[model samples]
Target: MKSERLELSTNDVKLADQILESMPGFSEKMLQITQRLLNRERQHGRYIVRDQLARGGMGVIYTVYDQDLRRTTAMKVLPPQILHQEPKVSSFIEESRITAQLEHPNIVPIHEIGVIEGSSLPYYTMKLIDGEPLTNVIRMVAREDPDYVRHYTRHRLLDIFLKVCNAVAYAHSHGVIHRDIKPENIMVGKFGEVLLMDWGLAKYVDADDNTAFEEAQDSSQIIEHNPSRTEDGVIKGSLAYIAPEQVLGEPSAIDKKTDIFLLGGTLYQIFTHLPPYEGENMIDVLQRAERCQYEVPSKRNPRAQIPKAVERIILHAMAPTKDKRYASCQDLIDDVEAFLAGRRSGGIRQFRVGQEIIKAGDKSKETFVIISGKAKIHRSVNGRNMTIAEIGAGEIVGEMAGIGQGARTATVTATEDTETLIITYELMLDELRKLPPWMEKIVFSLADRVRINSGYLHPLLLENRIFPLVNQLFLIYAGAHVQAEPDTPISYPLKDVVNEVTMNLGLDMASTTKVIDILAEEGLCVNVAEQLSIPSLQDFALFNDYCRCKMDINTGVKKIKEIQLTKEKDSCFRQIVRHLHEIDV
Candidate 1:
């Protein structure tokens, strides 16, 4: 379990750092030098190439100024060597035309799709993005850089995801399928602008897969469906995020669903800060992606603190089968929105106030999500009832059983009339199917904690354990409802803790209310206007002590039981021995 970091030679590291500081804008400086030496000012007739921004596998990007428009823009041009083939050059030109045709907020719009005059090489001009790619954002998350972490929070990331979904939905509406939906292909602006980039691999259909490019109005701009587009059945996107159908080159299977798979992959990176699949080489990654198997995000980093519902959404969107994925990008967006709003999808049932929806030791088949109203959780402890937690709307009940931890651990009764969405064992599967094994393990372990030694503690010992358990419950309530990292004092409603206490310890309403009052009166907690605040980390301090005390009591009680049985066995042995002696006498 010992952890270590690889040691590097500090000399070279320091040398590089010092040299880099001396020349801060080394790359920009080099680009400037190249521009001046090459005299690239007049290279492109109307657009004056200023600085070379980037070089891709197929083209190089230059920051150019449109002489006619009098604005700065980005121009993509093919390298002279690659422009040797007529078909290759022609296909590149067609791709530019197609990308320029689609006009959407998320899709980068083309300003001009043309060729370098006299050379016959294709080029295009578009808005120069003022941001980094989704790939860089992911890298920042992976590195755990504090500044970036502050920038890319879980909620913020999901917000970005929602925007991306809308963009894809727009593309779908226009009969365009962005075959490549990787993080590298998506640009995120500083002001929250998300642009889906690289439409070279994107396909346009008149209606269906059988739509002929020649018959279409933009026929001259559409490349005559040819083999060069696919080499040995491989497409333009990187292997890591390409869809299964794209990998297998399933004819006519390319559609919005394929992009949905890629969107799922993009989300995978957002959650786990990792691509769905990785390998030493392109072929290796392609093989794994083609297999349509992925390591679930929760499994990859259980401590990532991502919501399980979010994970499930991504998994369903990226289902191996096209039919299994969200029918459209909008469908995926709807589910993500639902999760963000704290709503789950399932069948709902209503319970009247004071009704016992579940009973301790009852068969557990379904988990209930409270959509409204409060509920009391109860359990028998030493011949008396106890409140473990009091739960209200937006909370879950019977989850321990619903997750197959066994029969119900505690009974849940409605404190007031309640409505809950019942996620039965069968449906719970679909909800949890995408979660990592450890996520399920975490739920099971918690259930065990809640049910351990129930109804066994002596009545004299029960009061001490229950008081601290109540405090622990209070902390849980605050955590769920308040800021996780608080800068100011947090005040949570008292009723919330009442439900939590009953949920955890199965205490009755009367007992739970009594304990909350006792803690308030004892200066252990503060109560104001029915809102309560327990100093951070203090609520759980007493609980830890109670746990230790309970463990000692359980050990002592076990020994006492062993001694009583042993004494009875000794007496029985003496009687048998006396009978044998009587026979001799």
Candidate 2:
């Protein structure tokens, strides 16, 4: 069998393109064959355009194979259909240059910028992310897909939001403002990579530019419900998420704060499953955005269970007046990070007397900050609910479970009508994650000691035993290796480590050695071959923090009787006024 290969010369390829263009009403089958052949023959420098991935207002994107690098990447090419348009070409070039300059993990990296050898089709290749737009994820969440709901938890969304914030902060630091930030422009990769896409509408802080072709320049092809297309004098961003200043169409009004507003809108959609601004028509939507009129996420979607701290952050970032909003992305990041860390001053709740605030053995993680009134701690000691201690305003309860220490160790019931602020489990975990490795082990150690027995050692001896010992142990572990990997253990001399801890705490070696055994039992450290080895430095650090917290609770419970009360009069007054209003008095 003779296999013969037929190759076309330059003239044959040119003639085929001419015939395909000139032929009128060609059969669909023949057209498909001809197009496939033409596409195979076409090459953009080292890239062979395989198929059109998407068609956007500015240009078309194609899945391209790079012959030089022997890899697949996405190529955005300014379509020949609009090559004659000067503004479109300029915007395309600007987008490539700007995106290339901003080297960040969260921003798509541009690899090569060039033009097709025989045509004026300018293109740029970028890393092809194996992901879907955040808008798609938001849709799945909106429809309540079980898997999506479980995977895209509020905490996960906030994590993604923070990454986008970092990208925006980087852009701002480089004196660039992303004028068109929306869910559509965010890509959530398969392996938890969050990327902020589309920078065509980005502008330099000092430039005065009218974006008549801004939306067209954006790489997102998904036409939103009502994209605010810019004319000679009109808005230049997605209508639903643009800042109020964007609605004014003043070039000077668009700045870093505008990006903050867009971020708030994205976050609002994340929690509420809908954009902040909505109306019956485009005009109405524009009017709402212009006035910054929108319900807080909870009000917009009660079932979303949006947290109070998150709502405050959204409102503060989306304030109608620029001056009222967060001054910078870093400021916005601080508030959001604080909320995630469970450092928020939560909303107040009133509990009736005799109400059980926490039940022993229950796996709950809410920590209650006492605002007013008193609570009694009770533990079931040998099948009897024995009163352990009394707590008043300025105290906290349920912290053991809050720090991921498993089940509640005791029961708490209000001795009198009580007021409290609650920290949720999710926020508690977020806060716990931020703890330094050393602090984490301290906490775990203290928690284990308390769990071992509320009255393990004499209170005086226990105080001296845990704190100084744990602190000294941490200093040795951290000082040994600053950058040790979690899975790899760090070894220190057992005798020396023990001597250091006991001498610092002024405690006997036997008591301090017992503490190390407990930590080992808790899977925090290992004692082997006369060496003190911390299997996971991170885990050891977590235990350290847990021990410290338990110490505070133990000592604080003892001194509750001696503490003086300083009431918040304004809070009481506000409650009274609210009660009167409810009763119409």
Best of the candidates, TM-score: 1
For model 1, residues 500-556, the per-residue Cα lDDT tens digits are 766766545555676556556645567899998765444334333333343344442
Question: For candidate 2, lDDT tens digit of each residue in 1-585?
Answer: 999998889999898788877876565668678756555444445677788878766778889888756789999989788799897799899989999999999999999898888888898889898889888898998898878877786768889999999999999999999888888889999899999988878889898787622333332333333543322124568887888888777787788999999999998988888888767666678788888888878889987667667888899889999999999999999988877766664467888999999988898778899989999886655343455568999999987777656678778999899999997876665555345435656886787766666534333342234545655677788877677664556887878877887666555676567667665654557878878887766645654554455445444332222222235533432343233223210
User: What lDDT does the true structure give each of the candidates?
Assistant: 0.69, 0.75
Root-mean-square deviation of Cα positions for candidate 1 versus the true structure, in angstroms = 21.2
The C-alpha local distance difference test score for the whole of candidate 1 amounts to 0.69
Give the runs in model 1 whose Cα sits over 4 Å from its true position: 1-45, 117-119, 206-234, 345-355, 358-382, 385-585
By summed lDDT, the worst window of 10 consecutive residues in model 1 runs over 224-233
Total colliding residue pairs, candidate 2: 25
Give per-model CA RMSD.
21.2, 21.9
Residue 502 shift from truth in candidate 2, angstroms: 36
